[model samples]
Target: MDTKTFGQTRLLKACAACSVVAALLGCAAPAAQYYPDEEQAIEDEVGAALPPGSAIVEFTTNSAAVAAFQQRVGDKLCEPDAQHIAARVRRREIPSEVQQNFRGLANFLSLGALAQIEKLPKTKIAHYPANQPIAFAATAYITDGTCGPLFLQFTPQAAKRYSLSMDFNGQSCRLGIREMDESTQTRPVKHSRWRCAEGFLGIGKPTLIGPDEIN
Candidate 1:
């Protein structure tokens, strides 16, 4: 073969080898790692556990409604009952069947269905502010009216323990690095607190508490 043709052939061979090497390298490299911070990782875990693209809703409220809600649901481990009531009130119109079920369940002495809800990995709560809007985690269904501020309770399925520092209605809900129970109940930690902005709730999904968080 002519010298010029031989050189061209060698160049083509070299280019082909380079292409093969590039393809192999690309395949070997890991996919994009999120490399999220502690809180972000927790949130990502929670988001993954939730239904695809779950919708979060916020409600408006007033003092009277808040007071009534507080009165109806006290701090006696009645998270389930409180959620049921809040769901109905925030929506301003729950199905008769749902209301009947909740009230009927309430009448019974079965921890008022608190255990039932606690057992589940996922739960939602609504907070209603009279004359404002009701806070819903998923969607809104208001029949009577819409006016003030509300909060929703979201019990994560995979998060055993998590902390939250959220700003709702210009107020802060702060907690430290919380623990998750085997049943996936999230509660606050005493020390290890941090200032988080609004809409930041750390959920503890099945994640190896990284070395940084540990140390």
Candidate 2:
């Protein structure tokens, strides 16, 4: 073949080869991951363990009432009674302080659910490894109407122990976390202890909450 014809032929072959590779790459591309019915998944895996009708409640600044309720609940706080306790708070049978703790715990679980719904970071924070920190901006239904520009941190203390901290509504509290026993009927997802503090709760879990949950 003449030089120009040969060059044209080579060019056409190269273009065809490029097209084939592009097609193969498109075929090899990963399928999008979808978690359909996530809410149901949460209800099944986590919510089922909670007391029936358990949900995120609002937080308030009534320390005396909260403290009193804390004393009343005492060890029951760590038990499966969380849902029952939360129900009392919802019914206004208990003071807001108790609800505040339950709300925080609910929000914490909601944050975990949110993490699964989105992509949240798993990083090392303090002495805890693979901690998750939810930023103020990302705060949503998980906060349960708490004031924003707030940060929520969750750090695993042990096998089932975790810690949560947040400052909202003029009060600061660090919650000592406990996960419900999966084998038990109570099946509470978490139990927490509240200690009052002065300012913003320090960053307990350094893992950042961001697009990592999605990616």
Best by lDDT: 1
Listed per model in order, the count of residue pairs whose N, CA or C atoms clash below 3 Å is 28, 5
Instruction: Say what the RMSD of model 1 is.
Output: 27.3
Residue 30 alpha-carbon offset, candidate 1, angstroms: 57
lDDT of 1 by residue, 1-215 (tens): 11000000001222333344234323233332321232121112233343332322212221111111212243222121353332212111122333345544442433333233222211222222322222122111111122212222332222233322221121211111234565867454322111112332545332221111111
- Expressed as tens digits, the lDDT of each residue in 10-129 for candidate 2 is 011233333443343232334322222221111112322433323222222111112101112222212212321111010012213333344434435444442232222111112222
How far in Å is the alpha carbon of 2 misplaced in model 2?
Answer: 87
> Where does model 2 exceed 4 Å of error?
1-39, 42-138, 141-147, 161-178, 183-215
Query: Pick by TM-score: which candidate is best?
Result: 2
